[model samples]
Target: MLIREWMATDVLTVDENTSMMKALHLMKENKIRRLPVMSHGKLVGIISDRDLKEASPSKATTLDVHELYYLLAEIKIKEIMTKNPITIQPDETIERAAVVMLENKVSGLPVVNGKSELVGIVTQSDIFRAFVNITGIYRGGVQFAFSLDDRPGSIKEVADTVREHGGRIVSILSSTDMAVEGTRNVYIRIRNLPQEDLENLEKTLRQKFRVIYMVKDILKTV
Candidate 1:
C-alpha cells in the first residue's frame, strides 16, 4: 500500500516561530505527539512532544510560574525542532516509509509532494494498522507455520493439502530469513475448518512437512 492511502491528511502543523508553550498546547489539544514546522508554506523542520518536554523547565527548578511561562514563550520551535527532518513522498510504498522510520529512529514522517509541500503525516500507528490488515488478523482464522523446501510447488503442495481437508485459506506468508538453507518458513491462515478434522489434518501435514506451529481458537469451529 502507498502512503497517501493511509497517511493522515489533515495534519496539525506549526510555524517555525511558534512558541514552545503554544506548540505544546497544540499537541495537547489535538492529542498528537508531533507537529510539522512550516516556513512560508514549505516544510522546514519537525518537533515532537519529547523535544518540548526536554526543553521545558525541570520539576526541581526554583523558577516561579511566571519565569517558567516566560521561558517557554521565549523559546521558539525552531530552536529545538529537528532541522530538515527525514521525509517520505506520498506515493512511496508503506514499506519504504517503514524502513525510513526504522533507520532514522523516528516514529512519524511528514509526507511531501514533488514540490516539497507538506501534504500529510505517516506514523507508526498507520504502518501498524496496515500490517494488521495485510495479515488478516481480524478475520480470526487458524494460522499454521510449516518448514518446507525452497523448490517450486512447495507452497502449492501445502495449499492443496489444506483445500483437500475442507479448509479455506485466508492468507499465506512465507519467509526465508529464519529457515535453513534450501528451505523456507511458510505461514498460512485458514478458516472454515472443522474441529473434528483438525487433528487428522495436522497428522497428515506432519507426515509430509515439518509443522512448526499452529494458532487457532480451539473453542470456535467453522
Candidate 2:
C-alpha cells in the first residue's frame, strides 16, 4: 500500500500570521493534535497543542488571565511551530513511510507531492491498520514462521507440508532480508491443527529444514 491510500486528506491548517490563541482554538474546535502552518500558500511550519501549553505563561508569572490572553494573541504560529519538518511523498510505499516514522520517532508525517505541496497526513495508526490488513493477523488463522531456502520449490514444500497435516494456508510472506544467504524467513497463516499432529509436523519439518521456530493456533469453538 501507499501513503496516499491511507493518509487523512481533510487536514486543518493555519496561516503563519494567525495568532497563537486562534491556532490553539482551532485545534481545540477541530479536535486535532497538530496544525500545518502556511504562509503565502506554502507550508512554513507545524504547531501542536503541546507547543501551546509549553509557550503559555507559568504560575510563577504575575500576569492575569486578560494579560495572558493578550500576550498569546500577539504571538504568531510561525514563532512557536516546528520549522522544516520531515515529510513523506504521497507515492511512497507504506513500509517506507513506516520506516521513516520509526527512525525519526514521529507519530505523524505530512504527505507531500513532488512539488512539496502537502496533500495529506499519515499517522502511526494508519501504518498499524495497513499492517494488520496486509498480514491477516486478526483472522483467527494458524500462523507459522520459520526459515527456508530461497529456491523455487522451498515454498511449495512448505505448503505441501501444511496440506499433509490438513492445514489450510491463508497467506505467506518471505522475509525482507534478501542478502542473508539462501535462507529466508517465512510466515504462513493456516487453519487449526491438533497438538499431537502439530508436533509430528514440526518433528517432520525439523528433519527436513532447520526448524528455527514454529507455532500452532487452535480454533476456539464459541
Candidate 3:
C-alpha cells in the first residue's frame, strides 16, 4: 500500500505565529495529537501535545490561573514547534513510512508532494489499517502458517493444495525474518470451511509441508 492511499487528507494545521493557547484548544476540540505549522501557505514546522505540555508551567507554580493563560497565549507555536520536521512523500510505500517512523521514534509523519507542500498526514492508526487490510483478517477467518523452502514454486504448490481441498484463498504473505536459512515463513488466509473438511485439510497439509499451525476463528477477538 502507498501513503497516498492511506494518509488522512483532511488534517488540521496551525499558523507559525499562532499562540500555544489556540493550538491547545484546537487539539482538544479536534481530539488530535499533532498539528502541522504553516507560514505563508508553506510547511514550516510541526507540533505535538507533548510540546505543549513541556512548554506549560508546572502545577506547583505560584502564578495565578489568569497569568498562566496569558503566558500560553504569548508563546508562539513557531517558538516551540519542531522546525523542518521529518517528512515522507505521497508516492512512498506504507512499508517505507513504517521504517521511517520506527527509526525516528515518531508516531506520525507529514506527507509532502513534489513541490514540498503538505498534502496529508500518516499516523500509526493508518499503518494499522493498512496491515489489517493486507491480512484480510475481517473476511478470512482461518489462517495456515508454514516454513517452506525458499523457492519459486513453494507458495504455488501450497496454494494449489488449498484449492484442491475446496479452500478459497484470501491472502498470502511471506517473510524470511525468523525462518531458517534456505526457507521462508509463509502465511495464508482462507475462508471458513466445514469442521470435517477443515480437519482433513489440516492433516493433509501437515503431511505435505512443514505446517507451523492452522488456526480457526482467527479474528474472533477483532
Candidate 4:
C-alpha cells in the first residue's frame, strides 16, 4: 500500500512563531501528538508533544498559574521544534515509511510532494493499518505456518493442497529470518473451510509437508 492511501491528508499545522501554549492546545483538542511547523506554505519544522512537555515549567516551580501560562505563550514553537525534519513523499510505499520510522526512531512522518509542499502526514497507526489489511486477519480466517524448502513451487504446492480442500487462500507471507539453512518459514492464511475439511487438510498437509503449526482464528472483538 502507498502512503497516500493511508496518510492523513487533512493535517493540522502551526507556524514557526506560534506560541507553545497554542500548539499544546491544538494537540490536545485534535488528539494528535505532533504538528508540522509551516512557514510561507512550506514545512519548516516538526514539534511533538514530548517537546512541549519538556519545555514546560515543572509543577514545583514557584511561579503562579497565571505566570506559567504567560511563560508558555511567550515560548515560540521555533525555539523547541526540530528543524528541517525528515519527510517522505506521498507516493512512497507504506513499507518504506515503516522502515524510515524504525531507522529514525520516530512514530510519525510528514508527507510532502515533489515540490516540497506538505500534502499529508503518515503515522505508525497508518503503517499498522496497512499491515493488518495485507494479513487479512480482521476478516477471520485460519493460518497455517510451515518450514518449507527454499525452492521454487514450494509455496504453490501448499497453496494447491489448500485449494483442493476448498480453502480460499487469502494471504501468503514467507521469511527466511531465523530459518534453517536452505529453508524458509511460510505463513498461509485461508478462509471458507469447514472444521472437518480443515482437519482433513491438516492431516494431508502433515503427511506431505513439515507442518509447524495451524491456528483457527475467529475474532471475537476487533
Candidate 5:
C-alpha cells in the first residue's frame, strides 16, 4: 500500500517560536511523542519529547520546579528541532517508508507531497498495521508449519492433501533452507474446517511430509 493510504492526516505542528514547555504540554495532552515544526508555511524542522527533556535543566542542577519551568519556557523549539529532517513522499510505497525508518533507526517519517510540503505522518505503528493486513494476520484461518523436500510439486502435495479434506487454502508461504540438505519450511493458512476433517488432513500430511507443527485459531482477537 502507499504511504498516503495509511499515513495519519491532521498532524500537529509547532512553530520555531513555540516554547519547549508549550510543546511538551501539547504532546502530553495529545499523547504524541513528536511534532513537526513549520515556519512561513514550510517545513523547517522536527521536534520530539526527547528534545524537550534534553533542553530541561539537568537533575543535578539546584533549580526548583518553578525555575526549571522558566528555563524550559525560554528555550525555543528552533533550538532543538532537527533542521531539514529526512522525509518521504506520500506516494511512496509503505515498504519504502518502512525501510527508511528501519535504516535510520527512527520511529516515524514526515510524509510530504510532490512539493515537499508535509501532508501526513507515517509512524512505526502504521507500518506494523500494513504488515499485519498484508499477511492476513487478522483473518480467521488454520495454520500449519512443516518441513518438505526442496523439490518441485512437494508443496503441491501438501496443498492437495488439504484440498482433499475439503479445506480451502487462503495463503501459503515457504522458506527454503539451502544449508540444510535441500529442505524447506512451508506455512499454510486455510479457512476453518471441521475438527475431524482437520485431524484427518494432518494425519494424511504426516504420511507424506515431515509434520513439525499444526495449529488452528480465529485470526482476530477481540
Candidate 6:
C-alpha cells in the first residue's frame, strides 16, 4: 500500500515562531503527539511531545506556576524542533515508510510531494492498520503455519491441499528469518472449511510437512 492511501491528510502544523505553550495546547486539543513545523509557508522542522516535555520546566523546579507559564510562552518551537527532519514521499510504499521510521527511531513522518510541499503525515498506527489489511486479519479466516523447504511448488502444494478440502485461501506470508537454512516459515490463511474437515486436513498436511500450529480464527490468534 502507498503512503498517500494511509497517511493523515488533515495535518496539524506549528510555525517556527509558535510558542511552546501554544504547541502543547495544539497537541492536546487535537489529541496528537507530533506537529510539523512550518516557516514562511515552507516545511522546516518537526516537534513531538518529547520535545515539549524537554522544553518545559522540570517537575523539581522551584519556579512558581506563573513563572513556568511565562517561560514556556517565551520559548519558540524553532528552538527545540528537530531541524531537517526525515520525511517520506506520498507515492512511496508503506513498507519503505516503515523502514525509514524504524531506522530513525521515530514514531511518525511528514509526507511530502515531489516539489517538497508537505502533504500529510504517517505514523506507526497507520502502518499497523496496513499490516492488518495486508495480512487479511479482519476477514477472520482459519490460519495454518508450516515449516517447509524453500523449493518451488512448496507453497502451491499447501495451497492445493486447502483448495481440495473446500478451503478458500485468503493470504499467504512467508519468511526465512527464523527458519533453518534451505527452509522457511509460511503462514497461510484459509476460510470455508468446517471444523470436521480440520482433522483430515491436518493429517494430510502432516504427511509431507511440519505443521507448526493452526488456529480456527485468525482474529483470535492475533
| Alpha carbon deviation, residue 7, candidate 1 (Å) | 0.9
- Tens-digit lDDT track of model 3 for 90-169: 99999999999999998999999999999999999999999989988788899999999999999999999999999999
What is the C-alpha lDDT profile of model 2 across 96-171, one tens digit per residue? Answer: 9999989987878888888989899898899999987786756635677778877889888988987887777767
Runs with alpha carbons beyond 4 Å of true place in candidate 5: 146-157, 174-185, 210-212, 217-222
* Better-scoring candidate (TM-score), 2 or 6: 6
What's the true lDDT of residue 80 in model 6? 98
| Candidate that would win on lDDT | 3
What shift in Å separates residue 117 of candidate 1 from its native position after superposition?
1.0
RMSD of each: 2.6, 3.7, 1.2, 1.2, 2.9, 1.8
Per-model TM against the reference: 0.94, 0.79, 0.96, 0.96, 0.83, 0.94
Model 1: worst 10 consecutive residues (lDDT sum): 213-222
Candidate 4 at 73: error in angstroms? 0.8
State model 1's lDDT: 0.92
By lDDT, the candidates rank as 3, 4, 1, 6, 5, 2
Error of 5 at 167 (Å): 2.5
Q: Model 6 Cα displacement at 60 (Å)?
A: 1.5
List, in order, the clash count of every candidate structure: 0, 0, 0, 0, 0, 0
lDDT of 4 by residue, 1-222 (tens): 889999999999999999999999999999999999999999999999999999999989999989999999999999999999999999999999999999999999999999999999999999999999999886647999999999999999999998998888889999999789999999999885778998999999999899899998867764
Tens-digit per-residue lDDT, 85-136, candidate 1: 9999999999999999999899999999999999999999999999877877
Q: Measured by TM-score, how close is model 2 to the native structure?
A: 0.79
lDDT of prediction 2: 0.82
lDDT of 6 at 141: 68
Error of 4 at 102 (Å): 0.4
